[model samples]
Target: MKFMHISDLHLGKRVNEFSMLEDQKDILRKILKIADEEKPQALLIAGDVYDKSIPTVEAIQLFDDFLCELSKRKVQTFIISGNHDSAERMAFGGRLMKESGVYVAPVYAGKTQAVVLEDEWGSINIYLLPFVKPANVKRFFEDEQIENYTDAIRVAVEQMKLNTDERNVLVTHQFVTGAKRSESEDISVGGTDNVDASVFDEFDYVALGHIHGPQKIGRETVRYCGTPLKYSFSEIHHKKSVTIVEMKEKGNVEISTKELAPLRDWCEMKGTYMELTEKAYYENLDQDSYMHITLIDEEDIPEAVRKLQVIYPNLMKLDYDNQRTRGKAAFLEAAEVEEKTPFDIFEELYEKQNNQEMNEEQKKLIHDLVEKIWEGGH
Candidate 1:
């Protein structure tokens, strides 16, 4: 059986303070187009189908439409909730949706839930482990104390182990080992909400999520499918992709990845004003690509970005090296300089406002006035 694996669609997400509903719709449509061309038997969405716990009405409709499309094509879909998803909301009507070949696992009731799919070759037992904090799992267990990611994941994995299916696949969302995080990802309290890669021991293959970069954890059997687009400026260099796993039989599996082209690339460039002005410097740059330009000139650049945007119109930021231009001595000698205190600055401005300089007697009179005010005699 061949399965297309994707994650972190983050539908209803806003990018650059702009509504990303259209971008999301275009990407999902493209994904379904690819799936139709490839004709995969099953589709595995690891986690974080929506960008927020409370998704917008438009987001809900987008997902509902996508699920209906997959159902129409007789494609089996397995989805699990992530940190950003509301468990109860995702699981709503899940039982009814399962009849249409869609499996939504939002909460871990007592054990891990597996959607069994069979083809001409054999049967594949795919387990969905939704995102859960260690405290929540500990509360669920009520007896044993779960301290960290490893402990909580162990509970779910142990439940999955009960099923002795030959070909088993685990779909999960967590901060797994060897995966890189995007800036947009929510950090747990003190970064303590992470699971080690060792927690998934017995599964034949693991499709992971939460991290925005696709990577293998300790072994090739466990991998993150990553997000479909660059969610943050920190993820500017990310090349998003979806994984396709073809299971032959038992332990033998072939995993292939296909890149999902983003709407545009995010780039960060740094150079002196003179260099940036040269035609050859940015000749290869895509004019429509989003960019952050850092000007390393001796002074503030007034028209640097304005000029560059003539070449690269989609420039988002322009920073000048003004601090470095002042030199280290300026900062180091600050204490030694004749700097005015707040009161002194205020007095000087006041004198300027009155269009006259304050004599020693006048200064002394102002000081007396301030003292009288301090004494509540205003």
Candidate 2:
């Protein structure tokens, strides 16, 4: 059985206050095209179908169109809710949709539901474990000791009673231990939300989501498909793709990735203000691409971002790496006055305020005040 694994769609997401709807539409179409060419039996969307719990109308319609087309093609689909998704909303018409070969995992309570599909070899049981927490698991398994995210997920998987004799696939949205995170993902502090990869040892393949970078965890069978488009400047260099998995039988699987091309790529550019503005330098580049530019010029450019927007319409961020900025850091570090005596400190302050050393009369007055304050134990 062949299927495509993708996650973190984050539809209707906006980067730097710029809407990504058009880019999302373009990428979804590309995914459809890949689906057509690959002709996979199913497409597995692990989680994060929308950018927010309450998505915009356009986001809903866009996802609807994608699903409608898949239904038309008679392709099966499996989806689960991520941290950013409202499970109740995502599962609103899940029962009805399942009748048409679309399976959406409901908000997990106690038992995780598995959708069984059969191939020539045998039946492949696909388990859907949506984003879970300790509290969610504790409510159902009152007797189980679910202390953290790992314990919660471990207890939930144990209740599934998975049969090792048959091929089983697990689809979940989680922060698997050791998986690298991108700036775009909302991660918890101190790795408190991490789940161990060993918990999924029984499954033939584990499809994961949540982390924005596509990568394998522990073994080749467990993987995160990543986002289709870069959502932050930190992900400027990511080569986004959809994972393709082909399972012939129990413990026999092949995995590959299909690259996705966005309407405009996310990139970072560094140069002097003059160089960046020169027609010769930027004339051939893709002005529509999202950009994070760093200026290396010493002098500040007035309305730099506004002016750059004329040539690069999608410039998202601007920063300076010039001498003045560098000197400011050095000056701050060198100006530490903790070791100086109060009189010395006052003298430096007087010099700065008056552009000269303190006069004799002023010095006498300050010395008298300091002596009086010291004598009084202040």
Candidate 3:
């Protein structure tokens, strides 16, 4: 059985305040083109179908058209909601859509039934596990002690009663431990949200989402297809593509990717104002590609932004890297709260308030509290 795996569509997303509707529309078309050539029996959309829980009307319409096109091609499509999506919204009319070969995974409620797919090799089970928090699963299994994300997912998979004798494919949305992070993703404090790759040992192919980079974790069978387009300058180097998986048997699987080209590339450059503005620099290039330009001039360029827009209309960001800016002294030290865990920030506050560091016991108490809060204790 062959499958086309993709995720993190992030439809209706705005990067640097610029709407990606057109870019998204273009990419979807490119994916459809790939589908035509590959003719995969099934399509696995891991998650993050929408940029938000409530997507724009345009985004919804765009997806509807995409689904319609897939149905016309008679391809079986499986979709799940990611951390950014509202499961209730994604699962709406799921049963009805399945008649047209679209399987939308329902909201987590203790038990998740796998959709069995048939091939010449017999039946392969496709399980759908939407993005879940420990709190979401803890309530249903009061008897189980779900202390963290790994525990939560481990418990859920155990209940699936997987049969190791047959080939199984899991379509889930979660950040697996060891996957590289991207600037545009929303992750938990520290690495508390990671799900151990060992937890998915029972599956043959684990189709995953949430992280924006396309790569495998632990084993090649477990993979993230990544986004179809670059969502941030950090992902500018990413060769966005659709992952194609071919499974002949339980252990016999082949994986490859069909490259994608967005409407405009997300890229960056650094040079003096004069060099950047010269016609020789950008005249032969696609100036409309979204850009982050760093002006290395020693002095500020008057109305540099306005002048640059004439050549590169899609300038998403502008910055300066000069001696004056780099050599400037800090006005006040600011903590990188985004990079700190909840407990780490709390400890800093405790030390500043009492003019003393917390003891091991106090630290333990706060650490436990932080864990509890993430599990919905507060």
* TM-score (all chains, Cα) for each model: 0.79, 0.86, 0.88
How far does residue 155 in candidate 2 sit from its true spot (Å)? 0.5
Model 3 clash pairs? none
Candidate 2 lDDT score relative to the true structure: 0.90
Better of 1 and 2 by TM-score: 2
Clashes of each: 0, 0, 0
Candidates' C-alpha lDDT: 0.80, 0.90, 0.92
Between candidates 1 and 3, the one scoring higher on TM-score is: 3
Residue 101 in candidate 1, Cα distance off native in Å = 1.2
Q: What is the lDDT of residue 127 in candidate 3?
A: 95
| Model 2 ranges off by over 4 Å | 327-378
Model 3: runs farther than 4 Å from truth? 329-378
Global Cα lDDT for candidate 3: 0.92
Put down candidate 2 lDDT per residue, 1-378, tens digits, no spaces: 999999999999988899999999999999999999999999999999998889999999999999999888888999999988999999899999998889999989798878999999999999999898889999998898889988998999999999899999999999999999988888565789999998998999999999888999989999999999999988877889999999997778999999998899987899998888888888888888999999998888999999999999999999999888888878876776556667777888676433369999999999888888888995
lDDT of 1: 0.80
* Candidate 1 local lDDT, 1-378, one digit each (tens): 898999998899876555668778888888888788888999989888898888899999999999999998888999989887888898898898888889999577768766778876677888888898777677778776577888888876775664554778899889985577777776654568768888776778899888888888888889888888877789887778878888887878888888888677778888887787677877766757777787877777677767777887777777766568456657756853567554575476665433358788878887887777777954
